[model samples]
Target: MKKLLLFVIVFSVLSAATVTFWAHQPIIGMEEKPIEFSIKAGSGVRSSVEQIASAGVPVNPTLLGFLARLSGKSGRLKAGNYELKPGTTPLALIDQLARGEFAQEALVIIEGWTFRQMRQAVASHPALKHDTAALSDQELLAKINPQYGKPEGLFFPDTYLFAKGASDLQVYKQAHSLLQKRLNEAWGRRDPSLPYKSSYEALIMASIVEKETGQKSERNMIAAVFINRLKRGMLLQTDPTVIYGMGDAFKGNIRKRDLETDTPYNTYTRAGLPPTPIALPGAESLEAALNPAKTDALYFVSRGNGTSVFSSNLNDHNRAVNKYQR
Candidate 1:
């Protein structure tokens, strides 16, 4: 009986030593890269460890789960995506999971899209929690900011990265806050001689410039044209604002009658800037609107490809229009 007791003691010591060695062994992989792992919400510690074992981590589920419970970390498991690196050990996995370290997901907002398009992109993102899916534009605008009644041109265009499964509201707030910061900074440093009465008017001009920049190199020139026209008491006559006013009636093409139609956004029929921005403007367009190129150009027409020809007089503008538009 004494010999049997000694055998059991020796066997238990060897088992503990084996477990301790396994806990520190690094999980190497092909090309020594990291492996992706996920733990869904409500997953218990046992199931989570089983998932890790199945993710090619070279682990024993029962042993890892036992270790997790033994180390008093079973109740601290979090749900989200994880990047298990090349040197991650079985013990480190438990600690990493308990800390809720999640992989980031990205959403890219294009520069010239309207608020409606931006909302659609946010609502359809798989990684977002879809908390704002049912909210209308006006309703969502209220939640984002109450002072701004209209939603157009309020968001900055850029790639936003966030942890997996983050709420959609989090993204909106981040973008909104960043845009305000940039706009305020840009407004504070704007040129003193510009025609804008307020930063919002500059933003409105920036949106027009964003849409009209068929050739990125011509952004400053386009701003110069509008600025000259605004200064000379001439009609802006920009087609993009006219198209924006048409709304659903604009079938991808603008007719002469469409130009004649009266709307708050129709630059050809109305005077001064539009009531609000037509699209989200990027940094270049915003800068151009605030400080245009040093030129007398007051007219431009598209040259068929993505560029335009600028002219300072009506006769030259008409000649260029006949050369290009005809």
Candidate 2:
């Protein structure tokens, strides 16, 4: 009976204090800087408050939990990582928890970046949980799905927003899913006469177009030049493919022998698409690959002003190349 009476008295004091003082009081241990904490999925009000307290955020867990229950917000508690900042009142904290406002982070995967570059960026991201950091490239692909044989050009380039502390794989999965959606949709709406044997081949063409198009507006023309080359049984002969084949050996320049060297990605030495994508391709590149411009042009020369000049024959291409490149 005394213990019950003591509990009622303490609860009464906290309730009265909340109206005038307690709810407005600043939480302890966050004056210097904000602290990040997490409430695990399925955690109740007491567990969440205690977890925050355990992370050195000194708040009256019992009183907060009691107030939450009294205010009919106990069942509304949402889980995820959160930030506890200085001057955060008890009422505001509860509201934050109730609204499921998780701390968010943005990661950008750039278009035309290699798979290795993408991996490096993801590995070095500070906000991610790094669950896939130790996984091998193939193993990482397997973690996403066993059907994935390679990682290159498989992920879409975009800004992804995820809850802070989310697994890095979440970003990967989101990108992969989005890329597949875009690729499949583009394939479905593709020009029927395109020379690609499959959607994957279109993806390879997209990667090539992404790399070779120096000007953003010339993607369709670049795709057409390559498509014309492919249809005529001529070499794709793209420099980026040769550089991709050279791997670390490329020193910011492509030599004659480098183009002559036989590798799966050396389009100068091989007649068909490379074994895998060489870089991530953006949606515009994919669209261009599926629907190249209708043109007789089989060659392109960069105009040195971030644009290209196309030619239907070798003589004109050589003249343009001499004017711009030589």
**Top-scoring candidate (TM-score):** 2
Report, for every candidate in turn, its global Cα lDDT versus the true structure: 0.89, 0.89
Residues 111-223 of candidate 1 have per-residue lDDT tens digits of: 99998899999989998899888888888889999888798998999999998778998898888887788888888888888888998899999999999998888998999
Please, what are the lDDT tens digits per residue for candidate 2 over residues 122-197? Answer: 8888889999988999999998867869899999999999888889999999999999999999999999998888
lDDT for model 1? 0.89
Q: What would the TM-score be for candidate 1 when compared with the true structure?
A: 0.81
Shift of residue 163 alpha carbon in model 1, Å: 2.6
Q: TM-score of model 2 relative to the true fold?
A: 0.84
Model 2 — which ten-residue stretch has the worst lDDT? 23-32
* Candidate 2 wrongly placed segments (more than 4 Å): 1-35, 40-42, 53-63, 84-92
Worst 10 residues of 1 by lDDT: 27-36
Stretches of candidate 1 off by over 4 Å are: 1-28, 31-99
